[model samples]
Target: MPVSRRDFLKMAGLGLVGSGLPATPLKQIARNVTTDNAASMLYDATKCVGCRACQVACKQRSGLPAEPDAQGLYETPRDLSANTWTMIKLAKENSEISFVKNQCMHCLEPACVSVCPVVALEKLESGPVIYHPERCIGCRYCMAACPFGIPKSQWEENLPLIQKCDFCADRLAKGEAPACGEACPTGALIYGTRGEMLGKAHARLASDKNYIQDVYGESEVGGTSMLYIAGVGFDALGFPRLKDDPLTAITWPYMKAVPAVIAVMASLSTAIYFRTHRDKGKQNGEEASDGSKD
Candidate 1:
């Protein structure tokens, strides 16, 4: 689908390429971490200095590889890829500039989880999106279906699989904050229950003029575990103004037609196979008859 210029700006701001939804959105986050609304992270752009410390920490903690912008800057990655699960992006609006941290939105009803044929992606009860590599079939459907285009494939592997931030699932399992959240020196990234994160974000917006009036991830696509507060308007910082509907709702109706198409194609192929064999048999019989006459 051709996206509006505004949506385009949102993707560009994240430094993401060829991914994301049409701005349709998430639902109410779970109140309790173990239930559905588990831990969440709130990113405040006004306090971010673009130090890239969180990015490094995530790489270290998760054992994720780095791209190092091979042909460009020494350490900065152009975007999240198979190697980099988290990234820090910079956007400018005139004299004002903000640094945005980009990762999986971890949607309440994630489209990636919904479309996966093998159930490789799961929305964890503790507020993380977890992936199982063994279940992946290399379909790349998740890559196409993700609203944020967060999932990436490891092209270099003999048997590559999809990859994205799982909000540091292993760390969360041990009751530890995500490595990125812990590494944030300026308190730009804070980790807690989703409710706590939302409350803090709203409180900041209520008390501070430096923050934009809205929390970016609170209502965009049902609701995501990750939330954001920026001094500049979200659009100015390359964030999409998404609706509150889950991205799955926007896709399921069209997806239902796929099975019907496959059935039709299967029937057509069977008819063609029988017809070709019949024609070959008739041709053979005619040649035999001609040989007898000779």
Candidate 2:
């Protein structure tokens, strides 16, 4: 869904090509040591009742306006957008049903950060992948590079920018939980340190026989600040199956070499331009000299 003018204004109030080279070694990526203590949230889908309180809270906290449907009657967003950062989705499996929350996964080795040429997207030591709008150039590489399809553009605005969850960095800094987590009345969403969240998820999986025995975002794409567990298959909830390896491991060297490649191309172009222009100037000079002799 497209964002409204009011939503755009509210957000205003508040807020890459690779070169040919060997891929960077995975061991050298240097995972942040603070990730263990970084703020994280665990979403237990089994406990969710599709209340949408979290969604409403997110909109209020982010100062985003309601986005209506195509009919313009109800504020029903089908997926994440520049206006709607976090949302609730439903998944059905067999005779059971579950509610799934969709938002930024905030990957530890974020492909968006790796692909962004301007460093507009940054992964913080505290686990939030924050965006610097002033630094963004509207390349939308982050939109395409995100495995979860989280980042979205403000298509309705005259000057559009990307938007997504920041894990409520301001609240984190103030020693508070995210608005969405705090709004969940059912205890479906639990907030804690990444280490603590992971441990809790593991404990629940071991204790409860109903859980799928898998923790989404625990290791996918080298882990994420947001974790999830459901009784149904993750695929049913629209979770993509991914390897533990971070995507940056493969994209780093090429991204790192982009400046060098651009420099070489610029030099070649300059050389060709100067060489052709100089020859043309010399020919013009000789022609003038011959005309004078005549």
Strongest candidate by TM-score: 2
lDDT of 2 at 24: 29
**Tens-digit per-residue lDDT, 158-187, candidate 1:** 999998998998988998889999999999
Per-residue lDDT of model 2, residues 1-294, tens digit only: 243433443444453123244542455333355887888999999999999999999998999989898899988988899999999999988888999999899888899998888999998888899999999999999999888999999999888999999999999889999999999999999999888998999999999999999999888878888999999999899998786768776666666879988999999999998887877977788779777755
TM match of model 2 to true structure: 0.78
Residue 149 of model 2, lDDT score: 92
Give the distance in Å from residue 239's predicted Cα in candidate 1 to where it truly belongs: 2.1
RMSD per prediction, one decimal?
A: 9.1, 10.6
Error of 2 at 49 (Å): 0.7
Q: How far is candidate 1 from the true structure (C-alpha RMSD, Å)?
A: 9.1
Question: Which regions in candidate 1 have their CA more than 4 angstroms from the true location?
Answer: 1-37, 69-73, 251-294
